[model samples]
Target: MLLSSLYIIGITAEAMTGALSAGRRKMDWFGVMLVASATAIGGGTVRDILLGHYPLGWVKHPEYLVITCIAGILTTGIAKWVIKFKGVFIRLDALGLIVFSIIGTRIALEMGLHPVICVVSALITGVFGGLLRDLMCRQTPLVLHEELYASISALSSILYLSLLNGDVTQTYATVITLTVGYLLRMAAVRFKWRLPNFHLESETSAH
Candidate 1:
């Protein structure tokens, strides 16, 4: 029940962010919905396709799609507020990342996947939606940029799996993972902690 509620919140937050991106591009309503839906569920769709999981989440639960669409349209009316309180959005996004990661890990575990595959699934679920949102908006994918986004997802999944392996209760494990994951992401953002970049300078021609 907790996971389900968090999943809804995660999708709604993601949809709003996607809508904001579309607004920046001056896209139409249809474009807003498209980007919003992609940002909210694109990761799960990709993960299901790769894992050969039948009936994608949004497909099975059409209400999820409706929620994202509604959230996107609503965002259009409150874009200013969203932009004005960017920090709140960032925190929400961080929470969503952890929620998505936990969902992905649980699904893979139910499928009897290897731990490594489970981690990969979590990473894809947590990061791919934002990647799609950025790509559709003609922006660089945040996953490819200097951020600990994907790493945090993987770490959260690993922690969740580890707790389960240690014989922790599902509820407890989830709570612990969510708390740690959210803090890690927020700390990364606050400290500008990120993976190193590889910058190749242009060769200067000898005059």
Candidate 2:
């Protein structure tokens, strides 16, 4: 249940960030709610569908849905406040990335899935929500081009799986993972760490 509590925090943080994105485009309240919900829960939904892990999060936990919507509406009133605290949202987003991955990894383990699938589940749960937000907003998906976004998610899977394998208690492991993941992600952002990008400047560059 510790993970569940952290999950709530993660989604609330994510929803605020999503609402800010919606406000950037001058969207209505309805649009804000829609984007907020998507950014908060969309990744988990996609992971559930991929793994056939039925009874999606928002459906089973309607309170979480309500929380996200309320977070969205509140963002509309405090848009300037949200923008001013953008750094805080980035930290929250990093925290959410790990929490979502850990939660996904646990579910996959419960389903008797392979470690590889568990990692995949973590990846899906971490980044698909942002992907959905970008698509809905008609903006380029940041996950695809940003500094170690999905890589951080995928890497957290390794730490989580390793911890579980080491006979660590789930609660302790979750906390440790959260601390390490949050630090790692924030470091990456602060350092501008990124993957090597591929670009083709020529029309006939490759075979």
Candidate 3:
């Protein structure tokens, strides 16, 4: 029940973010809904395809799709408010990442997947939606450039799996992972912590 509620919140938040991206591109309402749905559910769709999990989440629960569309349209009306409170969105995104990661991990575990596959599933579920949103918006994908985004997702999955292995209750494991993952993401943003960049300067210009 708790996970279901958090999953709804995560999709709503993701949808709003996608709406903002659509607005930045000056897209019409239909485009906003398209991007919003993609941003909210694309990750799960991809994960399901890869895992051969029948019946995607949104397909099984069409209300999830409806909720995302409604949230996107609402965001259009409150775009200014959302932009003004950037910190709120940042926090929401962090929460959503953890929530999505936990969901992914849980699904993989239920399917009896290997631990590493579960981690990969979590990473894809937590990050690919944003990747799709960015690609649609013609923006650089944040997961590719941001501080510890995918890493946090992987870490969250690993932590959750570890806790389960250590005989922790699922609820407690989830709460612990969510708290730690959210804080780590926020701290990464606060401290500008990032993986090393690989840049190659043009030799012709140097010459």
Candidate 3: the clashing residue pairs are none
How would you encode candidate 2's per-residue C-alpha lDDT over 1-207 as one tens digit per residue? 778778998999989989988988889999999999999999999999999999997899899999999999998898898789888888888989999999889889999999999999999999999999999888999998988888888888889899989999888888898888889999999999999999867776557
* lDDT head-to-head 2 vs 3, winner: 3
Report clash pairs, candidate 1.
none
* Full candidate order by lDDT, most accurate first: 3, 1, 2
User: Candidate 3, after superposition: displacement of residue 175 in Å?
Assistant: 0.6
Segments in model 2 whose C-alpha atoms lie over 4 Å from true places: 205-207
TM-score of 3: 0.96
TM-score to true structure, per model: 0.96, 0.95, 0.96
The residue-by-residue lDDT of candidate 3 on 1-207, one tens digit each, is: 988899988999999999999999999999999999999999999999999998999889999999999999999999999999999999988999999999999899999999999999999999999999999999999888889899999999999999999999999999999999999999999998999998887774844
| Model 1 CA lDDT for position 101 | 97
Which candidate's TM-score is highest? 3
Q: Who is ahead in TM-score, 1 or 3? A: 3
Clashes of 2: 0
Tens-place lDDT digits, model 1, residues 1-207 = 999999999999999999999999999999999999999999999999999898998889999999999999999999998899999899889999999999999889999999999999999999999999999999988788856999999999999999999999999999999999999999999998898888776995678
Determine which window of 10 residues in candidate 1 has minimal summed lDDT: 198-207
Residue 65 error for model 1, in Å? 0.3
Against the unseen true structure, what C-alpha lDDT does each candidate score?
0.94, 0.91, 0.95
